[model samples]
Every structure is written in C-alpha cells, then in structure tokens.
Target: MVRALSFCAASPPAAGPHRIGAGRSSEVFAEGPDRVVKLYRQPFEPEAVVNELAASRLAHGFGLPVPEAFGIVGRAGRTGILFVRLDGAPMTVRYAYNPLGLLPALRRVARIQHAIHACPAPGLPSQHARLRHQIEGARVPEPLRRAALAALDRLPVGDRLCHGDVHPGNVIATGAGLHLIDWQKASAGDPAADVARSELMLRYGRLGPAWFSRLFPVRMARRLIAAWYVASYRAASGLPNEAIAAWRLPVAVSRLFGRPSDTDAELLAAIAALARQRPDSESASLFSGPGRSPGRGQPECCR
Candidate 1:
C-alpha cells in the first residue's frame, strides 16, 4: 500500500508532504490552504506530466471549468505541481444514492466532453497512440493477441482531446459549474471512442445506465457506445491485465445487463453465444492475454 506523506503545518510548503490522491506515477497533497501539490515518486515521462498540466491550463483558457494552476513546486528531477484547489463534493458520492441526479450531472459531463472534443489535438496524438498501439513485445497466446491487434487496426481516425478516465469521480460540482479533476489520463484521440469509455465505465462501474443512456445520442449510442466501441477502443500498455479484459466482453456485458438496456442484453447474448462455440480451453484463454497489465485489475461491475 502507498504511504501518505507527513503534513506539517508549521513547516514550509515544500518541507512536508500531505496526501490527497495517488495514481501510478504521483501523489497529490495539500501544500497549503490555497494550493495543492502533485509529487512524482517514481521516474515518469516528464513530457506526460507536462502534457496534463498544459492540458488543464488549456482547458481553463478555453473557458472550461477546471482547477486553476498555481505553478511548479518541486524541481524537474523530483517533480511536483501546484494548483489552486477547488471545492465541491465528488459527483461519485452524490450519485451513490440519488441515482436520479445523474441525468443533470451527466448533462454537465456531456458539455465537458463536447468542449474537449472540439479542441485541436496535434501534440496530444502521441499520448493517445501509445494507448491505441497494440502490445506486440510479449509472448501473448495466438488468437487473443490477434483479436486485440485487430481491434487496434480498426480504430477510427480521430483527432480530439479525450479524457480517458471520464467517470463521475473525476467530476466535481463546484459553484462555477462542474470542475474536472485528475487530468493524468487526458489525451488527444477519437472523440467517440472516449464516449464509449464513459458508457462502459458507467455500466461496468455499476453506476447504472439511466443518466448515461440519456446523454448519448443515437449515433454515439450505436457507433461509439456499442460493440463497435469495444472493438476499436485503445488499451494503454500499462493497463492491468484484468482492466484490459474487462474492457472487452465481460465489462460490456455488465454495462448492458446492469442498466437492463435492451441494446446491451442483445449485445451480451450475442457475445455469450459466440463464446460457447469455442473450445473450453480457448474460452478459458480469453480470461488471460497480453492486454493484462500488472496492477489492481478493474472489475466487470463495481459497487
């Protein structure tokens, strides 16, 4: 488990660490009343961190609601970023009981998505390409790797900034409107594919389907929210093995069945029926593949 850094009120802001949130590369902390800090513990692609910070600033510049930047706190070697802390309850907690509120909340999400999708993404494509590019180095079993590669090849030609993790947890209900947090996974890529991720996560995360279904239009629902979405969606190299598989059928099934979406049920039944024809060994093999990364795997459906 990760340790929380010590927070010393009397010490200088850089003299101590305060835990806020942890991701693969960095830990967020409160530097003071007005500033939050991100300290990178491990060697990270500095450009990636710069990209996220720049993306956040760009979003703010575009008149999109997001946290304000304070400046860099630590040096380039031991990285840390400072930003103006925003206040609000995470939409995740709010939606836990009052699922009905999701509709209004999702409208806010849709607006954010629309704004980011409309932004020009030239330097950002490499980050997304890393995500969409197939993993060919490992000794992946035959057919499954083929399927993943096929999925990679079929990805649509798209150019837009994608908030790769667009779940409710990343959104906050601040007074200025919804504020987006955690820009770590933001990238430039296909907009619909990003929408597909939101659909899958909402369904698989067991957040339910009512609000999600309301937001997606017919084209997004059919093209970006269905089987096509799963087939073409990218999986980053660092994604855990479980997260990779979950992105495919099982999670998609959970999304479909959990919401009790007619489209999802039909899609689930079709996938299951197809799976039944494969040899038992081959069927079991689907559960393991090159896509699995080494970390906490995502659940097919989370409570």
Candidate 2:
C-alpha cells in the first residue's frame, strides 16, 4: 500500500462519495477531487487488484496516460483500488449521445494506442504467454486451437507496452485528450497483437444491450469504426496490415473463453475464416494482395 487512504467516508457529506461508473467487474465511486475508488463486485479476489496496482504504477512511471493507482482497500465485503480520479466520460458514453464524434474518437484512440506501443515496458508480464495459455484453454475446435497456437508461434515477439484490451468503453474522453483506464490486462509484447486485440474488441466487443448492437445499422457502424481505427493505427505506425491480420486469428481465439456470448460466434467465424486462408510460406500471413481481406475489409489506409 503506497500512501493508502482509509475507505471510511470523508468530509463534505453534502457531496459525499457516490457511484460514478459501473462495469461488469467493478464500480467506480468518486472519493474526492484527487481520488476515486474502483470497487470490485462479488466473488472478487486480490490478485487482479494487485496486478492493476503494479501495472498502473509502471505505466504512470513511464509517462503513459494511465491513472495513478494508490493501493487496495476493503469495504462492505468488496475489494477496491484507489486511483487518481480522472475527469471525463468514457469515450463510448460520449459517442452514445453524439454519434457524429464516433469517427474522430476512434481515430484518436488509434493514435493513443500507437503512442502506447512507442513506450516500452519490459517489466510487465508476457503477452505471448497469456495468449498461449488462453488459446490452449479456449473452447474452439482442436484443429483451430492447434492452428492458433502455430500462428502464435510464428508471429514475432516484441517488447512494446501492450494494453491487452482497448475497447471504446476503456478509453475516457477528457479535456486533455483520451485516457486509457483499466490496467488489469496490461502486459508487454508485440504491438501488432495488441492492435489486433483492439480491433477485435472494437468490432465485436459488446458496448450496450445486445438488442441495440444486433440492429443492422449499428452492426455496420461497428465495422466501419473498427476499420477506421485500424487505418489510423496503420498510418501512425507504418506497421503492415498483414502483421495485424496475422495476429487477429490468435488474439480472437484467446478472447473467446470469457467474453459475452454475443461476441463468441462472430469471433469463431472470423477465426475459422482466417485459418482457412493458406498463408504465405515465408511470412505465414493470412492477408495478401489487394483484396480488403475477409471480415476485415474496410476504408483503405493508403489514402
């Protein structure tokens, strides 16, 4: 615990601690101007919080846009971490009300993702290790699982900082710019795999009620936004689209185990499609030659 603060209610009772945001794993409550507490819901354990605290401090020390994690605190039988409160609405919430901002917000997040990769964080856990563990344990067919493992073994390992997860909901739109939250999944690895994970989440990760995302227009919009995000990242990093596509198969497989049921089918179909394509012998890339690529077709980054 680094400068830990007690969880008991503080002064200014008129505007006391209250819930500011809620997610599947945790609820955030504002403690004061400088700090907020992210309280994990039932069946919580200390390991994730411990990881978040370490990862957050490391990211902050590296001058990344991550919030400073203070330490862990217990309250009402739940575990929470105190963080330097950031003032902003999540990028997804902002876009929910202003659909027009969707493009710019995604583009900005792409740049943020690229910037994150530029800063190396070798002290963090291995992204490759996590992918291997998850893919081996995923519910996909054995052939697909073996293919994913082979694909994982083929991709180049890197030492760049990886957020591991970067859906729109994880980014906050602040006055300064977009800030990334949720550090439990932070790790160090290839930027391409990280970008693939971001693309997968943006394209299929659930944001709201399933009914809303199932709508035809909403589904199309999700595809466009995800494509735009990749285009932006490609422009900034000059990382070949082939590399990102190669990573998509394994990353999608790794994500299937614990995601919402709505995302599983799409991921499975995409994984199967990528696996069917005979990759280049030299590079083993599923993407090649002028075609926009299956399931990942979108606006050209070359423009």
Candidate 3:
C-alpha cells in the first residue's frame, strides 16, 4: 500500500506532511499551508477524481459554498487530488449531543439543496434513465426492483444539480461559511428527488432525527416520508452487486414500519398495521438458513 506520509514527503519536502485522516478509497495529507491531498486507493478511477474536480469547478462557478479544487495528480497507477482545506469541525460531533441543533443544520442543508437545484447545466442524466439502469443491475429481489422502478417512473424530472450525497458528514460549517465536499456522484436532476434522497439518508442513517421531528411533527402524514425513503434508496444505491443492496430494501421497509412521518404517515401506519396483523413471514429465511454464509445470495460487495 502507498502510504500518505511517504508519498507526501517525497513530493515536496518544503510542504511538510501532516497526518490527517483516511477513508475507504483515499487518505488525506496536508499538502500545503491551506490545502490537503487525497491519495486514491488501488482500483479507484482517476476519471472519478477528474469528474469530481470538474464538478467542484462547476460548483464554484455557481458561487456555491464548496471547497476549491486545486488540481489532480496521477502516476504509475496512483491517483490523487488537491483541495482547499475547509476550516471547520464536522457537524456530526456537535449535533449528536445537542439534538436541538438539528433544525438549523437541516435548514442549512435545505438551503444548499436550493442553491444546487437552481444551477443550470446541460447534458445531465435523467433520473428515470439512471434509476432504471440501477434497478436492472441492482441485486435486489425482482419484486422489489420492479416496485422501485415503478416508483422512479412516477418521479418528476428536471434540469437541476444534485449533490447525490448530502448528509451532515459531507457538510463543514466553517467560519467563512458552510462548505460541501465529496462531489463524485453529483448529477443534474430533480430537486425533490435530491431532497428525498437526503431526507431518506438522514432518517435511515439516524442522522437527522431531531431535524426530522422539527420539520414534520407528530401531526404530519408519515406515509410520504416512507415513500421518499424507498424512492431515494432505489435511485441512489441501486448498484447491482453493491453491498448497499443488502440493506437498502430492508431499511426502506423499516422506515415504513418503524417511524411515523407527516409525509408518509398513512403508508407507515398501513404497513406497520399490516405487519402487526400478520405473523412474520419465513420467505426471507431461505436466504439466511443453513449453507448460507453471511453474504450468500447477497451482493459481492457485502463480502
């Protein structure tokens, strides 16, 4: 494995390497006084990095609060990029303790969403086309896949920029302003679909419980939220053989059966009520019983 410190040190000693953090695909290294380097892992596409860099540029053109992309580096199968270091703490640590902070956080997220949706760009992919491709390739059950495709077909299509992933972790509340990072999955699409995806991510990841409560109190219809959750997962994580498939459908159904939302209240109550009336079905057991490893019959990404 190529280590961050070794690579950073070799590149330019004048800019000393400083330990930052690493994720599944890359490790961050302090490259300059105000910039960081993202060293990509093996098999991670250089095109993805280039695409994200282009997106960051596009975001900057729109005057959105996003990190400045310095440039990208590639050599001997290794790839990396330089970005302006956002000078702010992750909102996650702060929000966990003060749940009341979720409202403001969500409002900020919504405003960002509004900004992106207002952007005008051409040659963007259609939500229906993308969702259809995903469902066809996704490793979900045929029935569930069909259901998701049907739902996707009903969604409105528009020419708006979508962050694709807008959870709190990607947002940095800085002294200057809130900056968004990670643009590899961005595309132009409907704002509601984007908002729905964020809402689902927040609800399913248990990231915005407080904000959700504040936005849609106990009196709102919960069915709409459940529908939004399922639709978002179907659209975003429908990689045919991805590990996300194992949890996507189940999690979507969970939102319908577990929580109550103003948007999806009726649907949630109906699903949960039906579940309560019937005994647990053993149909899914075949996928879990003897001869099956934890990931057997599931996507390879799970293993």
Candidate 4:
C-alpha cells in the first residue's frame, strides 16, 4: 500500500536501516532522519526503477509537492531509490480514524491535484496511449472493450500533467503541506481525465478489508466522498461534468487489469450492464456512477 510516514528529527543519522513502510512494488526503509530508501521487491525489472526516478526528477523540476529522488542503488539484488523523507500521515488514514475530517481532506487533495495539473508536462508519456493500452488489455467482453476503445478515440486530447493515480492513499498530509507520493503512474494528459481517475480510485480503490466496503455505511461514505471530491475539483478547474463522464467507460474497464485486490462485485455488475450499451448512447448514462478512469504503469490501480 502507499504509505504516509512520520519521522523523528531527534533520531540519529547513524541509526541502522529500519523498515518504515511497504507497498505493492517496494518496501521503504529509513536511511536517516531526512532520507529513505525505496527498495523494489524481487522479480521486478529495472525499468520500473528508471521510470520512477525519471518521473520524480521531472516532478521536482516542475516544483510539485513531491519528495526528491536522490538516486538509485542495488542492494542484495533489489533496486532502490534514495529519497528525501517527509514527515506526515496519509490523509486517508487520518480520515479513517476520524470520519469528520473526510471532507476537508478531500478538498485538500483536490486542490493539490488542481495545482499538479497547472504545471507544464513536456517529458511525460501520453495519458491517452496509457488509457488505450489498459482498456485494450482488460478482460472485459470483446464488444465492451471495442466500445470503450471507440469512445476513447472520440474523447478530447489534452496537454496537462496528470497524476494517473492520486487517491487519498497517495496524498500524504505532512507538516510542510500535503505532499503526494507514488509518481510511477504520472503522465501527460487531460486534467479532467486525471480528475476522473482520482474519483475512481476514491470510489472503488480498496481501502480497508474487501468485506468492509460491503457494509452499507462504508459504501455510503465512499459515495459522498467521491461526489464532493469531483465537485470541488470541478469548481477549481472549471472542467465540465460531461467531459469527465465521457472517460468513465474505458477508465472503468482499465481497472480490471493489474490490480492486486479482489474486484468489487458492484463494479462487475455495473460493467456488465454498461457493456450492453454504446458508450456514447443515452442508455450508457448508467456510467454516471462516481467511479472509473484510465490506468498507468505496473499494478494499474497504484494502490
């Protein structure tokens, strides 16, 4: 999982390497009071390390709120990236313990996303290409995939930077400010599409237990948060709902691949229904649900 870590300044720099946090791709360790090492898990490729390193440096150059990636190293057959550490709690974790903070947390993340979109993106890959790749590879029905792909081609292309995955889990609320992590999925694309992807992550991305989301209250909370996040983001960016809605089909299909968690039953049922209708048809209004957007990088969901 993406983690928001807190570090103590009093800790000596000479302290030995200790585990701090772990995610699907790598395990993080505290290298010192100001630095951490993100060591990729075994059986992974060096390309991932190269992608993340390049992405991080690009983000840093753009003046986004991201940790500085120092360099890459190999240790015990695992590749790692040395990064300047930030001290904070993940906005999701904080809101989980206290639901009252959810709205403000959502607003904070939305604002950060707007800022990220404001930056010029010259060196990133095409978000359109990434979306097409994921949608094509999804295990959905052939007809459904074709419809989504067709709709994607008809959608507008944009020139903004998109943090392909920017759910609360990737947003860390640190003392300095709200710092975002996990840039492996960062790409150049439409801000509206990026916002849609963020909404999908908040809606369907696994939070606690798979069963926990089945509860009425849990689902309700997710629904509200997703709605408000989109609303706030829309207000800030002036992106139309129709623009965001147009991307929902292919984005939803893209979620089916490279995800580690069990697929939610609600999502499957929704996709099954939408598969029967043309994405641009009025009948496809069923996709107005508050989830879905394109995927990027290994482990598509970027959880």
Q: Model 4 Cα displacement at 42 (Å)? A: 2.4
Q: Model 2 Cα displacement at 120 (Å)?
A: 1.9
Against the true structure, what is each candidate's TM-score? 0.59, 0.84, 0.61, 0.85
Error of 3 at 81 (Å): 2.0
Error of 4 at 58 (Å): 1.8
lDDT of 3: 0.52
Candidate 4, residue 279: the lDDT equals: 51
Model 3 Cα lDDT, one tens digit per residue, 191-226: 555555454555443323445643545323233433
Q: Lowest lDDT 10-mer window, candidate 1?
A: 1-10
Instruction: Give me the displacement of residue 154 in model 2, in angstroms.
Output: 0.6
RMSD of each: 13.5, 7.2, 14.6, 6.4
Error of 1 at 169 (Å): 1.7
In candidate 4, what are the lDDT values of residues 191-243, reduced to their tens digit?
87888788777777876667877788877777777888887776666665677
lDDT score for candidate 4 against the true structure: 0.72
Which candidate model has the greater lDDT, 2 or 4? 2
- Which stretches of model 2 miss by more than 4 angstroms? 1-17, 280-303
What C-alpha lDDT does candidate 2 achieve relative to the native structure? Answer: 0.73
Q: Could you tell which candidate, 1 or 2, scores higher by TM-score?
A: 2
**Local distance difference test scores for all models:** 0.51, 0.73, 0.52, 0.72
Model 2 lDDT per residue over 78-148, tens place? 78998887777777666777878887877778777777787777577788988999998998999999999
Candidate 1's residue-wise lDDT over 41-88, tens digit each? 676667767877877776676666778766556744578777777655
Model 3 ranges with Cα > 4 A deviation: 1-17, 75-77, 123-127, 206-303
